[model samples]
Target: MPSTPGAGQSVPGTAVPGPGPAWFGAVMGTGGLSTLLQLHADAVPGFATGAVVMLVLGWVMLIGLGSGFARSVARDPQEWSRSVRDATMVPLWGMVSMGLLAVGSATFVVTEARAPSLASVAFGVDAALWGAGTVLGLATALGFAVWLISRRPAHPLPTWALPMVPPMVSATAGGVIARQVKSEAIRSILVGACVVCFVVALVLGVAVIVLAYHHAWFRTPVPVALSTTTWIPLGIIGQSAAAAQVLSGPSLAGLARVYSAVVLVAGAGLGAYAVFVTVRGFVARMPFNTGWWAMAYPLSTCGLGSYFLGWQWASLLTVAVLIAIWLLCAVASVRAIAAPRHA
Candidate 1:
């Protein structure tokens, strides 16, 4: 079931893209775009931006991130240890599950506002996709959750890490419910899932701000500043914000805008840092080796967030930038694959 051919072919998961870091970009990208689409649909009449964004994000995930990971695995089958393989596989399914939700959501949106005739069929298709995707994603996540619990991190656990599990579990539960439900039940379950995703994202938000502060206080700039790690979490935070907006409706309009603004600000600030790093680092004769491209993960995250947080102009800008970065990363990864193994 893994999409990446080379990654999971020989090994049960070799052709399957590693769910671990490979998922970080796709998950955050799709989620953020969906969130923004939902938000725009509510605030403006006949807004098509969200739908387009979702489609584009989906395509990018499949082509750029998915293919990139596949190549990475193909280069070295042993890189994906059994433990890491399990960890990555869970999220790969999670992405599939999310894709189903997206189709369903899009169907509902289009039917309600645009064409009633297409509604029934699309809705049904949505259900089927969501169901299939959910089953796969859930099985993977559950398996990984068990694996994670049994295993220990290399160092002492951070306080913030503790809260991550509950929200994640809650979101997965919501995915299951969303896939199985019908009528009014579907909306209710999705709303719940969005809430959990946002909660998880909020915790992540706090962590990012903390990291930014830590760097500032220590006067030691963390390297890979512009790469995917720093800005992508904000994108997830933005998606959660947009999801909260959609679920809550007009009654929470003010709160929704505030959340969106916060996401936009966070994204912009982090994006600036990334840009500064890229420029400064490049001009100072810093190596732009294959390793530097890894930042594409976080850059994609920030780009996704930019689009989702109602920052339309910025979102478009980031998407373009992220696409370029992603391509560069892909080339680099593939080159690494062709390079002779040192050992």
Candidate 2:
């Protein structure tokens, strides 16, 4: 997933010549920022415009990055299998589905304009992307689980949770599409699918996170390069909260509220710790890699839960933190492009 050459002794996720799936993190993160800004649109009207711009940016990134990755796969079909076998890079496969889901969900929130003329088109687009993302997400989750069990990775990396989080992304994204679907029968099916996806993601993510924490504590210190992934757990936590909150209307409101409340409390604490570690790593000169983009979606997802819970301040605070990280990542990604060795 790194921007390095295909053949290299650098870290597994360090770099490759063509665009890797991890590059889709740009789209995933941009969509997250757009959604977070939209959450603050009520308090700051100007944020709505920014949200639209972010959505457009995400779309552009999806197109460019998707093409590049597709090209790489076409040119060298073995690269896909190579990446799958590379433990460090395998987790990034989840980003491919999640990136698509990000744009799909944001299409409704930011790009739709909510005009009557656009509803049908937006619905079609969201449904198509949601279907594609959800299916791909399921495959990624299963594929990663298979790899984990058979290979039995000797040490746990926080990025190990990356592959498990896409189903949660699917769950939350499906809730958005459910809102747009007109038929009650179809909506019910979507809701059920969301719940199922949430459970799959949460259960699998918990196992990975536990192992990651255990490794972080009882094993050796996490590499400075991988420090950002320490924050990856927050991605599932916040996404689960958002999925529950979004399900409140169609499901049990009180139960959903209570679940979201508990997850939010946990997210607040974990998020604080994640931010500290990220800053420490940055101060210690963590080089710019595709891994740096790892922080964006997880941090931005915390805002989703906060906004859904009507915690305006908490949501906006996440936006502030995400903005800072985004600025650094934006600059670093460009630098990485200019010099892959730095990646």
Candidate 3:
């Protein structure tokens, strides 16, 4: 099993790798942009338009990639199985579920802003996506952990956290939908589900994160190809914080919020270091792989988590940073289209 992701993928020129892990990250990031915009649209009306545009674009990419993967698999039936065995690629499969959750949440947020009357419809979309995403997310988190443990694993890297993140995404997104639904019975079930996923993701995710830390601290610097994935850990921190805060039901809400606050503040210290490392990476001209999309969705979670904490100023700063990341990704995409690269 390879330690590195191997190839940058022909994101524009090929179909199979076009649906690569980071490709889905683009969908996640775009949908995440919509969530950020909807959160602040009331304070700055200009964000509303971008919110809707991003919402639509996110959905388009999601559906487009879904179809692309379908066609690719139909043409080469072994592709899915191949990806599953590819150590460098398998962990990143969590992006599939993350993309679904991102788009689902964005759908709810945009509808809440522009079409209140359509909340029911939005709920349907959100709930369906949540269900699908949760199943896939659980599978990725649990299945990958088993796969890693059952075998002699390669050295740990930040990307190891990728497969662990979807449930955290699920926990946060599930909390949002749980509050939206009116049925007490369903709400109770959803909150329980959210809590279960939160704990599952948190325990396993943290262990992997700590081991990854030990690897970076005691071993070698993370290779340039996977450097962007340093931001990936933010997804776990931010989503877990956001999930804890958003969890409802009298029995869960208060305690969850308290836990959320503590993690949110502590995560900020590491978040700052992640940002510094990312900046220093620029001196080496960080390459634009799909992994760079980490700046989009995972980083946005930092802002989303802050907003849930009612830290508007902190959320705004995170948003400003993500906007720049978005532009850089756009430029990178255009450049990649013009000239594709391989490992």
- Overall local distance difference test of candidate 1: 0.45
Lowest summed lDDT across 10 adjacent residues in model 2 is found at: 1-10
Arrange candidates by lDDT, descending.
3, 2, 1
lDDT of candidate 2 over 159-179, digit per residue (tens): 778878889989988998888
Q: Candidate 3, 277: how far from true, in Å?
A: 2.6
Question: Model 1 off-target regions past 4 Å?
Answer: 1-81, 84-182, 208-220, 224-228, 280-311, 338-343
User: How high is the CA lDDT of each candidate model?
Assistant: 0.45, 0.79, 0.79
**Model 2 spans with C-alpha error above 4 angstroms:** 1-17, 84-88, 114-116, 249-251, 340-343
User: Which 10-residue window in model 1 sums to the lowest lDDT?
Assistant: 154-163
Each prediction's total of clashing residue pairs, residues at least 3 apart in sequence or on different chains, is 16, 6, 0
Compared with the true structure, what per-residue lDDT tens digits does model 3 show for residues 1-343?
Answer: 1124342233322322455454788888888988998899888768899899989999988998888887878888887777676655666668889999999999998997799999889989999999999998898888888866887466777777888889989999998988877899998899889989998999889998888878876886666555677888888988987887787556977776787778878788767766777677666776566767776787888899889878898888888888888888878776765664552
**How much is the lDDT of residue 180 in candidate 2?**
73
Candidate with better lDDT, 1 vs 3: 3
